[model samples]
Target: MACRQPPLNSKRPRTLLCHDMKGGYLEDRFIQGTNTEDCYIFYHWASIDIFNYFSHHMVTIPPVCWTNAAHKHGVAVLGTFITEWESGKDICESFLSSEDSFRAVADKMVQIAEFYRFDGWLINIENLLCPDAVKNTPIFLRYLTDKMHSSVPGSLVIWYDSVLEDGKLKWQNELNNQNRVFFNACDGMFTNYNWKEEHLQRMVAIAEDRLVDVYVGVDVFARSEVVGGKFETNLSLQMIRKYGFSAALFAPGWVFECLPTNEFHQNQNKFWNLLCDYLPTHSVSMLPFTTSFCQGFGKRLFFRGKEVHAGNWFNLNAQEMQPLFVDQKLAGAGGSWVRTRGCSEDAWNGGCCLLIEGALVSEKPNVSVRLLSLLAQASPRLFISFIYKQDCSDRVRLALEVTTTNSCSCENSQITTPQDHRKGTIPHLLPETDNLVSQFKKQCDTQPVEGWTINCYLLELQESFLENVFVNISRLPDADAKYKEKEEPFAFRVGEIRILDVNSLFAAPVQVQNLTMCNTLWRRGFNDCKKRENQLYLSTTLRWFYPPNTAVNFRIFCKGMEHHQSVTIAESEKMVLIGRAYNRVYRVVDIPIPDPPVGTSGQVEFLVQPITKEGFVGQSSNCSRLVVNYLEKQ
Candidate 1:
């Protein structure tokens, strides 16, 4: 069950995001559950390297949705293995009874991580252990670490700084001899949040070469003597960086939990933006890269430039590789504002798209945003494609920012007016003083959805490798003095971005094998569900498999038809996207089968469509389907 995928091993100071919610498991726990209600989602994957799903449960496995999203950005996902309170103390006694029991427990933990396909575990032992159990605690930690490393290479087992060597449950707040034994046993240690400046200095002294391995914990909720958290969480992050240590941000979802739902997205971005200078950005190395700029959760669902489902939904599995946007602050200069965020109002590919809306000022007429940190070797036949649209008439020139090995200077480069490049133009290269290069392309295809236009340009790269790519938007410099007087408003949206080697495009993965449905349950009617009065609620598990990473994910849809008395009309035959599956297994809970007349039968055909990393859909012939028959019982 070990995930053969390589684990995260960042040389820079790492950032571990520990998600601690009020109630651990929610709609996300069902894996493919269709959630209409409001849910919390983390989209700043580039800001952090490790994500730990934590709860009070003894085995808090990260839901597959989180794992899928995290893994897409090369971020490692970890589940919490915690013991707390009175009952936890008893659980520890049983596990730490003897050497064999401890090893067995460690093996089980490793198996869980392997089966779940997550990176590793966050060992948070918050309960007291007896004298004998304490003696065996380090033994358990060592065995778990060894097994995890061997079974899942590059996997991690981070210990929490809680228990003292004397068996007492004491929060040392930093690395010391009191809890150094456990730190030595594990890959890294997440220190408690109450640590002071002196504690951090001492921690650095003790950590020595392994300073990055010791995660200085910061409670975003501002518990204990933690310097600053919540809106000011960056204060603590800056301090942590000054001392040269990794950070463990506990409950970074404070924006979702504390702020209003309407403000969640803005506040979340603001919170992370504060730490931009402190945390290192993760680079994209994998090929066939694509992103719709989807935040994964949205008010409506759109697929392939069309609206598919019109209901509020949250699914981290569907989240694309988010663009690393740095907020541009004008500092109260006229009506000028330059910002970028995910918009649910419209999308060309998925549920959301990247929206850049703002007015231009004399000081900052053009906004150049860094889209991605890429480490890629460009081939001769490489293609870069993206869809964009301008909402306003203020003509703006668009350019792509790229970094090459050759030094090219943009010091004397002037901003140009928007041009009609319907037949493609040679990219404008900088002179020989800078590494940054700006390239522009011609419009290729116009999407049916709104005014979105697609641009696919073949890169005739003179250099071999690229370090980054950015999105640049600029306006023409007018000679009239009134040009600066009028703050030009521009609203542009990028629907999707795709980078691939044209000649070596990967073949679509084979169809899912062993397609089957089991544990089917049908419900007739419930009084509380007046909205779905005649809907037959069918709960089932649709299991299918393609290899791991065969395709990014499988989009589950149903072509259902309910039979009537006189004629078998195609009532429910409209293709409906029921849910999405990151893994092979998807639970079909409450797939509303329209109520048929008594004694009449109905059939539902579930389709599994694989979507690749480069936004390529598998052939219809290669799709797997499951047929389910339901009869109305008197």
Candidate 2:
């Protein structure tokens, strides 16, 4: 349902900390361009993988690169965690189930947090309770709280559900006795999207009078048809507090969660303007949109006739084709046709379209279907436009990210920016953002508090973009490549991406190593532990861009080899590389590099080739170790 927006340029900022765009991954701080003001809720997910990736960039990286810039602008950086839904059903699913696991994961997360100077974790309480997980959740939270506080005291922990319950509405963890105890363990709590106004008011009053702080939570999309109004709404911070809400979490739609890109403007930028009025460094998401690929008029038959190829770093989840093409396009112009290996048809194809004349076939010949599974989250919009080429201009296709459900459009907005000079109202010139931020800073210096974001949910995605291993889509024999069994460029392409949730940091430390490659089947990075064997496998279908053929030699990393019988790619002597885990605790491993392929572009695979017991004993935690270089006839 459509909701009313406050005046674009109001005399004062509104109530609430208008959450910046964080469908989840954050964009650059300076990428912002708006006038509204509100505190920002910077959403960042943490895991062993990302911790290692960003940690190395921390020292040279300025505070602005981390959370300091947001803080300077009165913004709060909340590091939300992505976890396994099974854990909420039982503590066994905890990330820190074992002492060894807990130590490794916790230490890494804390150290990374410390290195980046992050404020706190925007804890995903739901994932912990996705299944029958309510019982063990409290234990897990308390355990997590203790783990975090042990290293950094007063770390603000934001609960997805309400936590404050002081009498007189003070923040006193006065909810359910059990929940209150667990909630009290946190400095603040955010209500779920299911919360009503009365409950919200009570929670707000308590935050103001009883508790040190209060936060409200909102889902990226209608996780399950929100009980009330439109989901991604943002009111000003002052207005929110005065309206009886301590803070607001103006999260964007699902689009922001998968791949932050330009399509998320409606949900992301709208809130940024509304909140930047208060928060110094607001976080906005630019989730990748399928529209990025498509270019046609209207929604029907887009990408009708155009040869399309994915970029080397193409993220399927955020990809689309425009100018709908007919069946001919799927049949590659050069004898290529639609082919499905394993999985549903929708899951295999991206989208289909075709355009032709009475007796002419100048349109897209064959249109490949979209991979419609979980990857197709964005409802892409098509815009058919033309470009000027040499002699005559062809239809230079493009797509736009506009998913408003035909309702809830910000265009022709009822609210307008005030043109006349007017005096500031209660919210126009909010000093509370700075006040709140300042107060938060002082508290951190003295004693850290658990974090909070009112009525908002945060999921800490590990590789927000799946980076798993995928071997044998195309052939890789040393540095030579062949396509369609013909002399072609060798390429390593990625297909469906399978991801693992590691939000249970304090509960279970994960040993993510072991990469095996042979024949058509390459299995690497397997969790060797007995208990984990079942729950630790994540692999995607190989796109097989590289054709297997040719007689050539290649090495992944020659500088660090233990023996002369070097490692190789799956199946052939033509390709060889090494995969090792230097420090198992750091979840760091290196991928072997082979000689560059001759005349071919390849895709990056998230799969790893584990070192056989006899090969090597040391592994590097750095991803740089995984090499992907092939020369063309060099």
Give lDDT per model, in order. 0.74, 0.28
Compare the candidates by lDDT and give the number of the best one. Answer: 1
Candidate 2 scores a C-alpha RMSD against the true structure in Å of 23.3
Per-residue C-alpha lDDT of model 2 across residues 144-248, encoded as one tens digit per residue: 667667765435455545322221112222233434544555555555554445555565444444333454444444456343223324332433444443343
Q: Which segments of model 1 are wrong by more than 4 Å?
A: 1-10, 330-337, 405-447, 504-515, 526-539, 544-548, 560-574, 590-604, 625-634
What TM-score would every model get versus the actual structure? 0.85, 0.31
Over 1-634, each residue of candidate 1 has an lDDT whose tens digit, in order, gives: 1111122464578899999988578767756545556778788777788899998878999888788788778888889888898898899999898999999888888898899889889998898989988889888999999999998777899999998988899999999989899999889999999988888888878998888899999999997678899888888988899988999999988988988977888888899878888877666566667788887777788776778778787777788888776566555455556677788898876678988777777665666555665555566656676678778755566667555543321111112222411122333433323221122221112234657776656666755555556666777786778775787787888888777776534333466677898898988665354564555678888888787665767888887634344224365457677777777788877766666656666667788888765566766776797776666666
Weakest ten-residue segment in model 1 by summed lDDT: 408-417
Q: Which clashing pairs does model 1 show?
A: 408-434, 409-431, 409-433, 409-434
State which candidate has the highest TM-score.
1
Cα error, candidate 2, residue 120 (Å): 2.8
For model 1 the local lDDT of residue 269 reads 84
Q: Distance (Å) between predicted and true CA of 435, model 2?
A: 41
